[model samples]
Target: MSARPTTEAERLRRCRQVFELAVRDRVSMAVARDRLARERWAEADARLSAKNNTALCGTAAPAFAETDEDGDARLQWWQR
Candidate 1:
């Protein structure tokens, strides 16, 4: 709110407005507000969990192997 919620009435009014946004966005469905809220929370939690996980890091590139003058064995091109 432009003005701070200095009174309990003002605080409640702002709180209700915030809750109304969820209904407007369909995060709280008309017939199942509580269930929809849970689903919405679960989805947000899952995305946050994935974003913070160590396993999501990209793998490093392998270094090319040194070869002799013969060049018969090839560099690291054929290596796994």
Candidate 2:
């Protein structure tokens, strides 16, 4: 049987569980630090991905407007 991919939340939960286990078992400081680092990295990566997606799918604008007051207000290249 094939296995499904893990989601961000699941991975985070697993990382926390591992951290707790490490503390209980007196694992190396490096191991604990690594787990914490991985958790932080995952969070940062998720945030970056969300921001990029938002940028790509920007706010909607009028597509078939007869005239755009805002656009007209802006100075044209020739005017500049």
Candidate 3:
């Protein structure tokens, strides 16, 4: 298989190509898409709900963790 597209432009171009092919084939697999989305959401929800630890503002989002030690860890790269 070919390597995955690395750039945003290349990824969008690939998506357009896939969309065109799907349209030409009249392949509207909405059920599969819905199922996949549901499964993904369930998995994400499970991860977030596990151990009753759902506070994502501090654990998942780093931008809001500017004063956190973990957030300041990126400063090492900037300093280097």
Candidate 4:
């Protein structure tokens, strides 16, 4: 079977999981730090977009994100 992810959102979730799967023999401390840095940057960018993308979010405003297959309000890794 092809390794390609079925959708962009699925690929994103899988990538985030892989990136945060630290504390194992596979990833070094420096790599984990880099991932955290990238994650922080992404959070900042999202906050900015949340203010700017009013049309997309509408009444939900800055806190808007798509529900996953299980219908979760939070799917992104940074979210609780």
Q: Which candidate number has the best TM-score?
A: 2
Put down candidate 3 lDDT per residue, 1-80, tens digits, no spaces: 44674888866765666566556667765644455457769998889787757475556433543456556668887888
Candidate-wise lDDT, in order: 0.63, 0.73, 0.64, 0.66
Write the residue-wise lDDT of candidate 4 on 1-80 in tens digits. Answer: 54674788966875666566666547975777677669879997887777456665455535667856744544554476
Clash pairs (backbone) in predicted model 4? none
TM-score of 3: 0.33
| Root-mean-square deviation of candidate 2 | 11.0
Instruction: Give the C-alpha miss distance for residue 74 in model 1, angstroms.
Output: 87
- Put down candidate 1 lDDT per residue, 1-80, tens digits, no spaces: 33553888866765676577666776653435565557769997898687445555665446799957756466455563
Could you tell me how far off, in angstroms, the CA of residue 13 lies in candidate 3 after the best superposition?
A: 14
The 10 consecutive residues of candidate 3 with the worst lDDT sum are 58-67
| Candidate 2 deviant stretches above 4 angstroms | 1-22, 51-80
lDDT of 2: 0.73
Taking the candidates one at a time, how many backbone clashes does each contain? Answer: 0, 0, 0, 0
List TM-score per model, in order: 0.27, 0.36, 0.33, 0.35
Sort order, lDDT high to low: 2, 4, 3, 1
